[model samples]
Target: MQKLATFIRGDLVYDGSLVSDATLQERFQSSIDPEVVASPPLLGPKGIPQFRKLDFTRDPRLAGVQNPTLVLWGTEDKVNRPSGARSLQRRMPNCDVHLFSKTGHWVQWERADEFNAMVVAFLAEDSADALDFRRV
Candidate 1:
C-alpha cells in the first residue's frame, strides 16, 4: 500500500485502532467506552471465525477473474488494512481500487461521489450512454 500510494500519488490514512497489535488487547480489556455494555469483544473470538480459520498470508490468487473488478477501500479501515486492497488489485488483472481518505471500513458510505463515480464509470463503459455516468 505504501508503494502503491507513492506510485498513484494518493493518501493513506492509518488507523491506530486496528486489533492486529497488542494495543487492541489493552483497549478491548479496558472497556473505557460506554457503548460496550458487556466485557469487550462483544462477539468473542468467534466473532471473526472465518478470518481466524484462514491462512491469509499464503492464500492463492483467484482464477478466471478476467472481468473488470472494482475495489473500494477505506483508508482508515482497521479490520482490513488498506494494503489488503492493494494486494487484491495486484492479483486481479483488471481492478480499479479507490482508497477513500478519512474513511474507516465503509468507503462507499463515507465518500459517495468517488465510489459512485468509480462504479458508474465501470458500468457505463459497457453501455452506450457512458456519458450519463455522472447522472447515475
Candidate 2:
C-alpha cells in the first residue's frame, strides 16, 4: 500500500508543486479501489500490455471516428504526454482538446470541479445539436 501510495504521489499525480498533501491523499483514497490495492494486476507481468501495444501514429481508426469527441489531458502528466491530445484533435474531425495546466494523469481527481463542468457542458452542447438536427 505504501509503495502504491508513494508511486501515486510521486509519479501518477500532479508535479507536487501546487497540490497539498491532504488534498492529494483525500483524492487518492476516494479513487483507490480496495480490491485493486489487495491484488494489483496492473503491476504484474501481464499488466498494461495493451498500453505497450498502443501506436496512435499508426492507428487508422482515429480518423474514422465521426461522433463529437472531447480529449482532456493534463499538461503535467508523465504517463501520457500532452501531444497525444493534439494528435487526437488532428486526426478526429469533430474532436475538441482541453489541457489542464498543472494537473497530471489523474485529471478528473486533480481538477474535479473543472473537469466535471467541462464534461457536462460538452454533453449539453452535443445534446442540443442533436435535438436541433432532429427538428430540422
Candidate 3:
C-alpha cells in the first residue's frame, strides 16, 4: 500500500485510512451501486475477469503523479487518514495537502463546496500561469 501510494501517476493525496469509518462502512455495505458483488447479467455477458476489472483498486502510485497535485483528507476519515494524504504528498513532485478536521474518505462528496472551490482555484491559478502538464 505504501509503495503504491508513493509511486503512482496523477493528482492525489496520501489520505490514509487508519481504520474503516463506521458510516462509510455502513454505506459501503449498503451501497446502491456496489460493484464487487456480481450481478447475473454482467457476469454472464462479460465474465468474471471483466467484472473484477471494474474494481477501482489500481496502483496508488497512479494517483501519486507529478502533476499539480492536491491532497485533501478528512481528519475524521477512519479508512483514509491524514497519513494517507501525507504519503501521497511525499510521492508527488509538487503537492498541496488540505486536511478537513471533521470529514472522512468521502471528503469530496461531504465537503463538495470547499472541494469545488479548491479545484477551481487550482485550475484558475494554473491557467493564469499557463502551467501546462500536457506538454511534458
Candidate 4:
C-alpha cells in the first residue's frame, strides 16, 4: 500500500496538490481490507484471467449497442483517456460524453455533486424519451 500510494501521489494530478493525501489514503485503505484482499479481484491474478486478455477497445459489439448511453470521463484521468470517451460517443450513436476538468480516474468521487446531478438528469431525460416513444 505504501509503495502504490507513494507512486500515485508523486505521478498523478490526483496527488496531494489536487486531492488530499488523507482522502486518497482512506480510499486506498478501504480497498485493501482483508475481505477484499482475500477475494479474487476481477482484473487481478486470481479472478478471470481472460478478462485482462480481451481488449474491449476493438470489440465490434460496441457499435451494436442501441441503448441511450451517458459516458462520463475525467479530463485528467490517466488510466482511461478522454479520447476513449469520444470513441464511445462515436461508436454508440445514442451516446453522450461529459468530461470533468481537473478530475482523475475517480470522477465519481472527485466530482460527486456534478456527477450525481448529471446522472439524474440523464436518467430523467431517458425516461421521458421512453414515455414519448410509447405514446407514439
lDDT of each: 0.60, 0.80, 0.60, 0.77
lDDT of 3 by residue, 1-136 (tens): 3333332211122243423355445444553444545542233228777754543333456455766877778876655446767766666768888998767666776677999999899989878667565555
User: Mind giving the per-residue lDDT tens digits that candidate 1 earns over 24-116?
Assistant: 345344555566655545342444666554524224554346776788888777656879788777777787788887776656645768888
Off by over 4 Å in 2: 15-52, 56-58
By descending TM-score, how would the candidates be arranged? Answer: 4, 2, 1, 3
Per-residue lDDT of candidate 2, residues 74-128 (tens digit)? 9988877878888888999999999999888989878989999999999999999
Cα miss at 8, model 3 (Å)?
Answer: 27
Query: lDDT of candidate 2?
Result: 0.80
- lDDT string for model 4 (28-87, tens) is 887888998898365534456564455455467889999999998889877767788887
Candidate 3: worst-modelled 10 consecutive residues by lDDT: 5-14
Off by over 4 Å in 3: 1-64, 131-136
Better of 1 and 4 by lDDT: 4
lDDT of 3: 0.60
Which of the predicted structures, 1 or 4, would earn the higher TM-score when compared with the native? 4
| TM-score between candidate 4 and the true structure | 0.75
At residue 17, what lDDT does model 3 achieve? 44
